[model samples]
Target: MPYVITRLCTNDGACVEVCPVACIHTRPGAPQFYIDPDVCIDCEQCEIVCPVDAIFKDVDVPAEHAEAIDINASFFRQNKAVVGPVAFETAWQMVQRAHAYAASVGIAVTAAVVDEAGVPIAVGRMDGAAPRTAELAVSKAYTAAAFHLATADLAAQARQPWLRSLVVAHRGRLLPAAGGLVIFDGITIIGAVGVAGGSATDHDVLCCQAAFSVLETGGH
Candidate 1:
């Protein structure tokens, strides 16, 4: 039987790096990763490396995540390519759409997009926004991608020593603030988006979540 990846996956890309056959991948719009049934060697390298313990043999998948078996197989049989940045066009367009959403809501915000590795792709700020808004935007995106969770959700764990060290190790670049989020396209991870403009008590998270709709629509 083949291996499977379930929703519990953090999309941390740990299993992807360890797969010998390179069969582990996330299809476009897939909320979590999937193991290609045909190419998986059943060598269990991924299972050993999975930090979330989300990978399992088709037969061994626990009852809670059992749906992954068919989800993984059907993904390989359906789509021809995994969703990546190329599908989202250039970074400029992405930023524009993010701000467009912000504009519609009468907010002056800055937006940033980062790859799965937490590298910045684009950062755009609207007029009347503080210059540092771009910094917050980028840091938020980085934090989200690195932790594989929305920054707001990470807030409760932000005070943990391990998480604090993680931030320090990343050159003090991560911000476990409200405006960052992981962007998922099905089981595959497209990347992350961050927006900042509103105050801590106001629309920061609202604007950040709105960016998801912008991203899902291909930023058009």
Candidate 2:
């Protein structure tokens, strides 16, 4: 289970600093930090460093702050896949990085990240991007997480008759598109990232690739 950041979090950011996987995050001007259940390694590093003693394991959370458990998990409800511990803050940063990469290449796009269970961890769209692009990005992410393969590769494989039926069986949840790539923690498939809204499929692919590269490089 994941650790919960309670009401006592003072926005100190110490947990964020100590997290080895960079999973803890506080939104801009937010009152407290939130631990991303998907990305957390469950190392208890955050719990040890919290000066306010606000962090607690899922089962140990105080009743008054009990709602925080759902609050933390609900952050990744959209899309669906079996994913490991991933920090919401890190996932959001990955989207931001992907968006910036698209902009750098003169493209406008939407980016999404999902955990292994295909649950959306974070999503972002550039100004003027089409509304449908967001949905496509998320669908592609879910496909990658479900298949443990990049959506581009899955798209190619799905061309076979048997694979095509498998794709159809998903009832539109599986989008075998080029812009989705699986994320890994060493050899373990942890999640995926998807990109859409570019003029061509290659543009989307480029954005997703760049985003994964950011994760590989420690989001530098």
Candidate 3:
């Protein structure tokens, strides 16, 4: 069985840095980190390094932390896939790099980094960007993260009846605009980035692409 991170997890990131496969993840405000059953390699590194002793093999979880197995498992069940919630430092770097890229190209934009579940990890609005750009950026990131497809591809299908209905069902939180791209860590999806308020959708996409270089070069 895969290892599980219980409520005792402190999100201190000791285990995250130790895991060979990078399957441990938690957001900034999350109560604890979780291990992805789909991606974990069964290495006990997390359990070994976890300062709080929160990591446990599924079958070995103590009775006090037994519910943690379901909590950890159910988080992935709610998403199409949940390899990561993305480390906060990495998300921050992505947003900063995205905004820097947009500025370099003389464009004003809002950039957002969201986890696999489409929850915000980091966000930034360049100077002079429109206020509403923040919402669009987040929606675009959510579209890519929630569906595992870039907004460019999804926008083309937004005209179809089914796509239109899907957008509506989400109460318009899904943006089929061309500025979102999913991010990966060694073939495992970590999160997504979205950019908005650039000169054109293509400009937004270019900025989004540039931000990915941060991860490529640093593996952060």
Task: Find the candidate with the highest lDDT and give its number.
Answer: 3
Candidate 1 residue lDDT tens string, 1-220: 6788988998888999866446787856668888888556465778988887988898888999888888898877786556675234545666776677677777788988888777888778899788989898899988777656778876776786656766777788978778887776675456788888875524767666666665566563
Candidate 3: which pairs clash?
A: none
**Descending-TM-score candidate ranking:** 3, 2, 1
Candidate 2 local accuracy as lDDT? Answer: 0.80
- Best model number under TM-score: 3
Tell me which of candidates 1 and 2 scores higher on lDDT.
Answer: 2
A best-first ranking of the candidates according to their lDDT comes to 3, 2, 1
lDDT of each: 0.75, 0.80, 0.82
Candidate 1, overall lDDT? 0.75
Query: How would you encode candidate 2's per-residue C-alpha lDDT over 1-220 as one tens digit per residue?
Result: 7799987888888898866445676657767878878666465778988999999999899999999988777654432354464578778888988888888888888999998888998999899789999999999998888766778876755665545665677677888779998888765577889899989899999888778767777762
Kindly report which residue stretches of model 2 are placed more than 4 angstroms away from their true locations once superposed: 1-83
Ten contiguous residues with the weakest lDDT in model 3: 75-84
lDDT of 1 at 215: 55
Which ranges in model 3 have alpha carbons more than 4 Å from their true place? Answer: 1-83
Q: Model 3, range 1-220, lDDT digits (tens) per residue?
A: 7899989876788988866445777666879888878666465777887887888899899999899998987766665443557788888888888888888888899999998778889999988999999999999998887666688977766786656766787789888889999877655577889999998778999989888888888847
- Alpha-carbon error at 104 in model 1, in Å? 4.1
